[model samples]
Target chain A: MVTEIFFKEFHTPNNGIFLRIKDSLIKTRSKFQEIWVVETEGFGKMLLLDGKVMLTEEDEHIYHEMITHPGLSLLPEGMRVLVIGGGDGGTVREVLKHNPASVTLVEIDELVIEVSKKFFPSLAGSFNDPRVKIIIGDGVKFVKEAKDSGFDAIVIDSTDPEGPALALFSMEFYRAAKKILTQNSFIVTQSESPFYNKQFIVELLKNLKSEFRYVKNYIASVPTYPAIWSFTYASDSLELDVPPKRKISPTKYYHPNMGLDTTKEIVDEVFGCS
Target chain B: MVTEIFFKEFHTPNNGIFLRIKDSLIKTRSKFQEIWVVETEGFGKMLLLDGKVMLTEEDEHIYHEMITHPGLSLLPEGMRVLVIGGGDGGTVREVLKHNPASVTLVEIDELVIEVSKKFFPSLAGSFNDPRVKIIIGDGVKFVKEAKDSGFDAIVIDSTDPEGPALALFSMEFYRAAKKILTQNSFIVTQSESPFYNKQFIVELLKNLKSEFRYVKNYIASVPTYPAIWSFTYASDSLELDVPPKRKISPTKYYHPNMGLDTTKEIVDEVFGCS
Candidate 1:
């Protein structure tokens, strides 16, 4: 039986990559962006927001674990955390592994959360945890109004620095985020790709250094992302060398050793003494 | 006025990626595969062989320098080296940086050499150096019949472990290569992506281990490849940690520190104690 398959294309700014899809399970345009979940051949289920791939079932662990665990691992146990624009719930799932005191996920789009709950059960299931507080509002506005000296860590799992997510990358947003973060706290965010987004990464790193005492850029080679993705971690009073006492179980991609080594090696390449 | 542009697509086995090409400068069917030279917007010029991208002007230095330098750095001055199937001459260019006594580059296809010389002048110009000897023949037969205990390094710069290059990844090939290497000689070859070609990497690693005492796997995040490309470094009696005294000048990517750090970090992640 030779049956042909259709490919679902995800366009990058200059170049693009595509995945082979068996069927499109869900496709709808929300007030914020277009959302789709499709069953793929080798990559398993893929989630797309605004025609850009956010995660695939096979390799989501790389991005989710890298963004959440590295920054959170620097803090003590039972820490309060904030996640901005991670409506898909993968961030929340990784956060639960740390046994946080409470996790507040501030997503602006209600439909993104609703669609994820229906289509991505494995990721969205963490929402039912009693420690999670889901808020449907702009992350920028919410950070400004949130009480100061609260969260121990903040994970910005937003989309690319474009459109609605543009403000999230600005210095003003980082200042607001700093106001709410407890001393010795850190915030980790997806910067962009080094090959495609070098300028954006440079400006973001510079801006982060202006607001934080210690700012470092880390990198991960995610298959789905199809490029060397850059991540930014900023801390005012905390040292990020401390390893996590807790275990991250059932992970396909990350180990504590791999994470720390990646951070150290990439930090040197991006901001080395030489 | 708004304008529309066409994209030049390069399809992988199961999926694909595309770039915005200003024009397809050259296209021809070589004896072994199809060849292309395209001018891309973001990635400079791109070279495609058999419908798969071989290298781009933007990031080819990452792969070429990593493969050639780390292995060559271990040897003393004025050493003899052999390169199997590097038709493009990029590997030879990096090998010259160490001031080797002589480099014998054995490529199977003459057309590939000719095409690269015509289109990729910066890469193929190194062939005119007094130290290089270009041979157009079979690399498999070349290794099997080569003299024993003469060369300080052997670099297998063939394509993926398929088609004519299949023998380059076999146990028989490594056994043949092992016979000709000097006591402290090393061999470095490109393994495929960890995400898409895990089985191939595992099998190749196992084969190399049977023949060599110290077999290490290293990875580099190359943008055009779009996957974390792995490279295998195998040596009979040498430890790869020794740094190079010679300076690699006019290099955009490779520094001694960056190279060592990349090798260390990737070696741990790929073959870590944990």
Candidate 2:
């Protein structure tokens, strides 16, 4: 009898999701984390960093569009964007949709980029765009030393607040990030799940609020992640509770009037602030 | 050494969610299905029917509120309401918040009601309200034999379209349900997950559209369920796209201007309609 292989990622020590693996496509150790590409019966191909799901072919669009559009749609066209830790290139693909003049992707792990180029060409295809630039370095260091007031938007598409991505969630990184962003620019970060990562989100929001004049949280449902994935939008001058300034075409989930303001009350209720 | 126990519910044969059991509170086989109540590490107490998760203490509000308030809040206060297969009383509890003149709950299984009253008191507490009339019978028969245009609203809180709940998702059931609803009345049903149950939802929406003039879909994120859960609202005279006619207080998720129209576009995209 043949044994079946399954990939299990524990959200907590006791609870988690499991997918039936049809084949193990690739497995390797990167400098920062363990990287694995597995073909699954339910979600097609999935990429895991440190054994935690980074993105899956089935539901990556939800997470990618949510992290990119809400902030980018509010800004003018021909903007400059900087993406942190999205080595898979999904965020850059979405940023390219908004007609950005330039996009600089800072990914610490070069193996992730290489693996995506081989396995997930649809995502990695964005790297070939003339406007896009790839920076093989730590995002925190790039933000610290980069020219001031350079980018119109900064999208932190990092992993959970751990490993190399831990510093991306810190206050000091936000400060350095602020120095590199143009006036009226916005920074959006994947803020973990609203249900499972409440404490992390509460702390992240507090730090963002301290640095930005207008900080708001929005959510999208990503099945591969811990259900209700959240993103935090922070800016000093941009209004967070307005409709999209322009229409984003070819979107499966994100819509212009998709109730961005509804999340404020939900954030307050989840944190017991209201 | 002690062996650990966990409860697993598969959305598909290849994918599923698992929760560690802190304690097995209750386990028994009912005439209709297997009933199990287990104390979980992540979602507090959970009620399972036939090894499938029915509800969890941590996220039941999201499901119950989305299924109940969106339809009930659109109608006037003190309206007559009918709930089908909601033996747990959670839907009845949300319906009472709308100040319904009377509520008639028809559930096929009596054991579910007894178990809910014993273990899920917060949800079962609505049974004690004076306006509620519990009918221990099949929902399908009740809807068939009931007088024409009797109730102002009908909320279908049955399980997925399988086994004992299979008939509830049929076109005959929707046709019969429409006959029992008064003019300008609304009928809402839990339509399952958009990601995992796309084919089911497409068929359900088609049946609903064939029976009602206005049919719309709405979504809420319930972490315990399959991420994004869907609900469909159907009406003959009432507009399904308008805002909630009244406020629903003590809600953790639903808001009046929560962009009900957004789901229509999502439904179109998911089913490849537009």
Candidate 3:
């Protein structure tokens, strides 16, 4: 890795934005399919893969908040949680904050995890905890075995709905997801932006609604993500919302008082939930 | 103008992001320090200046919808409208959909309009309507001449708080805006994204609240914007949440049915509006 890359400011109507790509790299690694830890102005340590901003190092708060808080806070305390395809350990780190009994992260790619450990020590720290189990295997198979064992909440933090990750979004995978959860359990997945992929999100929502009794979609501002983002939460037991039961702690982007009630509002607008 | 500037793309997660800088070939004429357009995949065009994305190309529907509908819809039948700084013409386009008696668009940067006319025909076509007026001047000065002329709605579609356009976000400018409207009239401005610029939006909201009793904030999804954007709607007689009476035509966005209610909800959330 002997490459050198730099940032150039762009014309924006919002805030300071930057782009991080590989030029000539002196220090770079092949993790996941195309993962890179990017640093930007105002926002810090962002993760990028295939030139997409995966998670910002500075403001993982929004992603983590929307992902972890909505599901964990709604479930009973000390529930079992499983996260699929989160190699950066950001999802697991957020899950740990909820004080879950056992948190397992099954990531198919090992190099991504190794890269995260090397470049992102803070987020990678969650993997070192005893309560957290790191499994290197196919997430689909892992979910099958884990389904028989029983779980409370499952969050899938996978990549895009293309490439090898395509199976993650299939109906078969969702069927497995349904069987893994215990009664009164909830499942959350990162749906793409409603702007560029409204039809895609609509189809994803359709599939999810077909399986779950309760389904909801919420939007969040992920500067790195396309067309902002729509996150989907589903369950047979409880309604998903933006209103939070507990106060958020140590976050850069999410506010605890904001709650998950907003989640319900967005979902209501999605398919005319009202 | 003879020479052209080029932007380079960088790879992130699953997107191609672009950045711009001052080039010897292309000359920038704006009084602002610098301007850039960050181009990213799936997300819309992002604008940056001095290293920040102030506005992006994509996901502008949200901001444009909120800015145009509430103010125009609130007017009496056939009320005239004057839009300052909406040279890209998206706001004017939305205003035209309302089938107002007449509309005017004032923009300073002919270059921006020209660029849009070339690169973005959709926004440029917003200027194609017969009833719409296109003016080239500083909006701060243009409103003073139109006082004797009554306008049902006046929209300030300009940049953020700093530069020659800084005054546009000020009380004095709003006072001019107030003078341009008829009785029971309204105005709207592009408030920044709450996720990224809460302080800036809050400060602007405070200033507007000080001048108008009916003041509120609304949100939209812009992919390239630093954060999903929020806008401020203000009126003299009617509460901001109350839908204005109107029969606007079809729009790519802003259906009067859901549009009106969506604005109200966004206002309720951002401004603590009742």
Candidate 4:
């Protein structure tokens, strides 16, 4: 391993950012991909999957609150929620804050959960909640068989559409998610960087519009990420303009007014998509 | 000189991002600071002043357009303008698109102008416009003694508030700027990154609020910057809600609808400042 004052940049060959690592702790290969948890001087503990940053303790709230709150805020109270590919438990932690009846986390890699349990106990601790169920299987397969009427919201917190997470952004997966969502339910999936993944987002919006009645794109600026991160919100029945039914706690970034402002910017940027 | 495929990141000591440089081209020390012009694979030609990325060909439009358009759109018609510290001439180019009666650019460094003319002809070409008067002098001193009744818009496009540009953000300078402006005139200044320079921005807004009746903050996501780039709009008489008197062409990012949306987000994040 190369040790220097500055750490290796694990970004794609095209464009990338750097982090200063205080120490190298865990590095291992899982069945799905390579996993790492390193201590970063600037961003705290950072989780890396297949050499790409998944979460850092410092800015995870921005991603978690952004990915979960907007969709949950639009839904009715007390419900079952499904999270695909969020093995770190950050998304689950945010979802549970809303007092959901049940939260099912369908992460394909159990190794990610183990890493989180070891290096990120606070984040992974949510898995111990009585109402939480941990599933170690392919998210695509689980969503295919989910019941036709139970989930209030589905948050697809998958990595970039590569490796094990490729199927999560497919038309087949959106159809499956739509099938399992109850009336007034919504699904929000992590879209990649707007600067680098414009074509991918353009295609994803096109696919979602065909499967759902109303489609909205929301954006958040994650400092650890390359640029601005985006989330796609799709629903057939829920009116997005409707105020959030309940306020979730322990959030540092997500608020209704701020979310609405972001919504307008994202919608205008992708206006032609819908 | 180190020459390789990847470019060194000129970010701050605490945190920073990298750009893929095709080659290391120009590196020189001017009277003001170190200046560099390099070709990057992702962002094209980039200008770096004092080991910091200033602007790149790919995203310069986002910065120039966002800095100039919102304030210009709020103005009445072709009128006199003042630009402080925009030696690259990008801001002057954007200002010219509005057909202003005349533009007075006050840049402290003449070397910056020469470098831009040699390396960034497209950006610096606007200096040749008959309406432009390039003044090589201190911005703070120039604003303090400007004539009592001519300028309709003042754009402070300086670098960060750490160096010679320090005085530009002071309450004294703002008071001086307000003294020279016509009734409907407004001033817009680049306020640095919201994520990294929050405290600096908070202090700046406080200082401006002391001098201007209507103070509004706006932001734009420049992909190359640390995070979101911010601009401050301050006016004593203009109703910011007034629709733009005329349209400026050849803009890639700035539109009235999008500008309003960004204004909402920026204002909300800094609401606690006041």
Candidate 1 C-alpha lDDT tens digits along A179-245: 9999879999988876667778778877888999888676677777847787788998875543455
lDDT of 2 by residue, B157-184 (tens): 9998888789999998888988888897
The deviation in Å at residue A266 for candidate 1 is 10
DockQ-sorted candidate list, best first = 2, 1, 4, 3
Better by DockQ, candidate 2 or 1: 2
Query: Under CAPRI classification, how is model 3 graded?
Result: incorrect
DockQ in order: 0.33, 0.56, 0.14, 0.32
Query: lDDT tens digits, residues A1-274, model 4?
Result: 4335665553446466777778878999988889988898767899988778888898888889889987787665688999998999999999988888999999989999999989998789999999999999988999898789768899999988886688999999999888898987989899887666777887888899898988866677787886767888889987554236666665666655443323232345556311
Best model per TM-score: 2
Comparison by lDDT, 2 against 3, better one: 2
| Residue-by-residue lDDT tens digits, candidate 3, A110-198 | 98788788777888888999999889988888887763537898898988888868888888988888888888898898887665556
RMSD of 4: 3.8
TM-score of chain B of each: 0.90, 0.94, 0.76, 0.92
Query: Which CAPRI category fits model 1?
Result: acceptable
Task: Tell me the tens digit of each residue's lDDT in model 1 across B47-113.
Answer: 8888778888878887898788777877887989999988898999999988899999999889889
Query: Which digits, one per residue and each the tens of the lDDT, describe model 3 over residues B1-274?
Result: 3222344332233223453333322224454345444444334454444554444455455567668876677666677888888766778777776778888888877666765665456677877788987888888888867755388788888776677678889898888788777777888888776665666776787788888887766665564454556777888787654334664544434444332222222344456533
Model 2 residue runs over 4 Å out of place are: A1-3, A241-243, A261-266, A269-274, B1-3, B241-243, B261-266, B269-274
Regions of candidate 4 where Cα sits further than 4 Å from its true position: A1-3, A10-14, A97-99, A239-250, A259-274, B1-5, B97-99, B128-130, B237-250, B255-274
Q: Could you arrange the candidates by lDDT from highest to lowest?
A: 2, 4, 1, 3
Q: Write candidate 4's Cα lDDT for B1-274 as tens digits.
A: 4334665663556467776778767889888899999898778889999878889887788789988987887775678999999999999999998889999999998988998998898899999999999999999989887888668999999998887888888888888888888888999999887667767877777777788887866667677887667888889887454235666676766654443323222344556421
